[model samples]
Target: MTDSNAALNAFFKDFAQNLGRLQKGADVIAGIRDSDVDVGSTPKRLIQRRDKVELFRYEPEVEQRIDTPVLIVYGLIGRYTMADLQPDRSLVRSLLAKGLDLWLIDWGQPGRNERWLTIDDYVDDYIDEAVERICRETGHEKITLLGICEGGVFTTCYTALHKERVRNLVLTITPVDFHADVDDPAAHHGFLNVWTRSLAPEDIDRMVDALGVIPGEFMSSIFSLMTPMRSLTKYNVDLVDIIDDKDKMMNFLRMEKWLADRPDHPGAAGRQWLRELYQENRLFEGKFELSGRVVDLGEIDVPVLNIFALDDHIIPPTCSKALAAKVGSSDYTEIPLPGGHVGLFVSSKSQGALTKSIADWLQARDG
Candidate 1:
């Protein structure tokens, strides 16, 4: 009788607590507004504009400790806004607080009219122009080039070709060897690499020709397929678990906002990305060309800082770590952070380490 009574009391307590949580969750959901979930709230000023491409310099938060300005080059696939998602959890803010002068290129939303834009145009023209402008503005002969993902490929190529213009090179989650993922021990790692290699060259041409630009929706769908289980359960399971927590809910909504704002990739660039880089693996093989000149990775002799997420499924550790052997830099340094691709920038656990590592590395070479 005593055992039965205790069991009944425990069950009732759990049931009551669950009911209270459900009520709180409902109230939280009812109160959320678009303004309450704002992201990329860091202050910045646009300093240069060319067609759809714009360059912005972040306002310094402290006395600039580094004389050389650091230009952040984010991939065209995703917006640079990820670095500045929120004030407290921002890579931008943290770097600024550390007294680093920061600037970034915003490859503003590409459309049908921008379909003809190619990798050559981006590397030789736009990035070059940005570098020249930064040099003139800061009166520094060479500026540090910090690239993320695909942008790292561009910066690497740029550094190789124009070694005189770059003082330091920093790459985060950048894949130097597209085919390296085949050796990844984790089964789910490098889904993009496998999927891209599966498609024929003709298939890429057909898709680009038909669409003129790869729709953001199509790219988002591909990313979703990379983690099918997570895609299915994210809303129903993940969101529900944190619905009553304001901080977690805000983070979730901000990420969703960022994900939803994916820009359509220009057709010509998309074809080259999928074909020459992904399918043929030309970039790693030293056959990839930008503006009629071959991009040889070994030609990049600048002090290189390569950062990779240990469990990055998209880029994969093997793909990113391969840079250690390929670069000619005697000062090559690698940091393997714990988390997924996006988590390296946004996760609270990873942000402090990521920012501090970058600041300390850059400061060491600032002279």
Candidate 2:
């Protein structure tokens, strides 16, 4: 073949590939327009509700379940829907399949009305009330508590305050030692920690007061900035790689959907979290208090399972691994899974192992 014919063939091949990708992209867009994409599809019932808090009990998939129900508390900034992002890739579904009775505490999007709400209200009132309701419904005095990220911090505080109520405590990507950076600056990863610590207390107060309720979009933007190049690369380079595969594209869309659905955080709560926990690094030092009660980590006596993402950019592993030394629990287990903060739960590669570890730990303590 002549050089001209070879060049023509190369051009034709390139055109065909581009044409195929465009057709696939069109199909994806059409599916989105038709509202065919679904997430958080697992069935659940609202067992109890108070203020903006809703306690949902997921329908059991297995006939036989552990006696102690597992209650999941998600971080305030993000919606709980990520756990049940899809039917096949849902952490809730996986746990339920393992015969674990699951429940979730949904702190609905806080508006201007909730500007006065603080950590005291969330931990003392909302979570306390939910736990009591769960006990009443299941006839189990002590239940398993699983907290994710900031939710883990809340659960750790709750378990410390009411150790008798929590049979087992699980914290995923939880930041326990706010000052982990002080001991080893190099190990102190996550731009969030450094950024918050760099801010003055008055600065945080001014920002919170002006906003009334911190906009979810503002928070999302800050997180995206942590890896600005990667965020851009996802849409520019990675999107094209998975566009032809419907299943992969759907998975990517589900994650994007979850990230886009961030909820506004209450102003008062936001201020307290930044000032007391992040800036002052008080939680581990027993200086943090909720409703006049000191949150002493040493008070935690329940079996604690601390799971940290090895490559967590939001919360460093050292920050999470500090739980074992601080908590008074004799049965403390720490797992360093391979993934980022969110990947620990949703990544197909890690979710199964993560789910199994949780279920097995809970089952072992069920008796």
List per-prediction Cα lDDT, in the order shown: 0.91, 0.86
Query: Model 2, range 286-355, lDDT digits (tens) per residue?
Result: 7998888899999898899988888887888888888778889889998889988788888889888899
List RMSD in Å for every model shown.
Answer: 1.7, 1.8
lDDT of 2: 0.86
Model 2 ranges off by over 4 Å:
1-8, 182-188
Query: What count of clashes does model 1 give?
Result: 0
Collision pairs in model 1 = none
Cα lDDT of model 1 overall? Answer: 0.91
Per-residue lDDT, model 2, residue 339, is 88
TM-score of each: 0.95, 0.95
